[model samples]
Target: MNTDAALAALAALAHPTRLEAFRLLVQHEPEGLSTGQLVAASGLTQSTFSTHLAVLAKAGMVKSEKRGRQFIQRAEIDALKGLMLFLAKDCCQGRAELCEPLLAELACC
Candidate 1:
C-alpha cells in the first residue's frame, strides 16, 4: 500500500467499532461473514454498521462480495500485510537487526 492507503487504513482502524469489525472479519478469514452477521456482532443498527463497513471497504481493508441476496465481507489481509511492511521498511532501513525481533513476535501471532 502507498502512504495514502496506509494512512487511510490506519485512520479507519483508529475507531473502536471499525477496528472490532475488522478483527472479527479477520477471525472469520476466507469464509467471511454476511452484513447482517456483522451488524449483529457489533450490536449496532444495520445503517450504523454499514457506514463503518464502508470506511473499511474504502480503505481496502475490507472486501465485499454479493453472496446470494446479501453481501459477504472479508478482511483484506494483504492490505494489512502491506501496511506492516511499509512501517517495517522505515524502521528496519539498513538495519535488519531491528526488525528481526519484531518479525519473530509477529510470527507467534
Candidate 2:
C-alpha cells in the first residue's frame, strides 16, 4: 500500500467500533457476516453501524456483497496484509535480527 492508502486504513481502524467490526469480520473470514448481524453484535442502531461500515469500505479494508436481500460484509485480507507489510517494510532499519521477533509473533497468528 502507498502512504495515503496506509493512512486511510489506519484512520478507519482508529475508531473502536470500526476496529471491533473489522476484527469480527476477520474472524468470520471468507463466509463473512450480514449487515444485520454486525449491527446486532455492535449493539448499535443500523444507521450508526452503517456509517462505520462505510468508513471501512472507503478505506478498502472491508467489502460487501448483496446476498439475497441482505449485504454480507467481508474483511479485505489483502488490504490488511498490504498495510502490515507497509508498516514493517523498513523494520529495525534493515536489521534482520531486530525484525525477527516481530515476524515470529505474526507467524503465530
Candidate 3:
C-alpha cells in the first residue's frame, strides 16, 4: 500500500473499539460475522458500532456484504499485509538485513 493508505489503516486500527472489532473479525476469518453479532460482542449500541465499522471500511481494512436483512463484516487481510509490507519497507530501507528478523517472526504467525 502507499504511505497515505498505510497511514489510514494504522490510524483506523488505533482506536480501542475499532481495534477490538478488527481483531474479533480476524479470528472469525473467512466466515465473517454479522453486524448484529459484532454489536453484541462489542456491547455497544448498533449506531456506535456502525460508526466504527464505517471508519474501518473507509480505510479499506474491513469489508461488508449484505446477507439477507443483515450485513456480514470481514477483515481485509490483504490490506493488512500491504500495510505491514509498507512499514517493513520503510523500516528496512536499503538494508534487507534489518527486515529479516521481523519477517521470520511474522512467518511464525
Give the whole-model CA lDDT for all candidates, comma-separated: 0.94, 0.97, 0.93
Clashing pairs in 1: none
lDDT of predicted model 1? 0.94
- Could you give candidate 1's per-residue lDDT for residues 1-109 as a string of tens digits? 7889889999999999999999999999989999999999999999999999999999999999998999999999999899888888889778999899998998999
**Tens digits of per-residue lDDT for model 3, 7-107:** 89999999999999999999999999999999999999999999999999999999999989989999999998898778777788789898889889978
Q: With candidate 1 superimposed using the best TM-score fit, by how many Å does residue 73's alpha carbon deviate from the native?
A: 0.3
Better of 1 and 2 by TM-score: 2
Off by over 4 Å in 2: none
Clashes of each: 0, 0, 0
For candidate 2, give the lDDT: 0.97
TM value for model 2: 0.96
Misplaced by over 4 Å in model 1 are: none
The candidate 2 region of ten consecutive residues with least summed lDDT is 89-98
Instruction: Estimate the TM-score of every prediction.
Output: 0.94, 0.96, 0.91
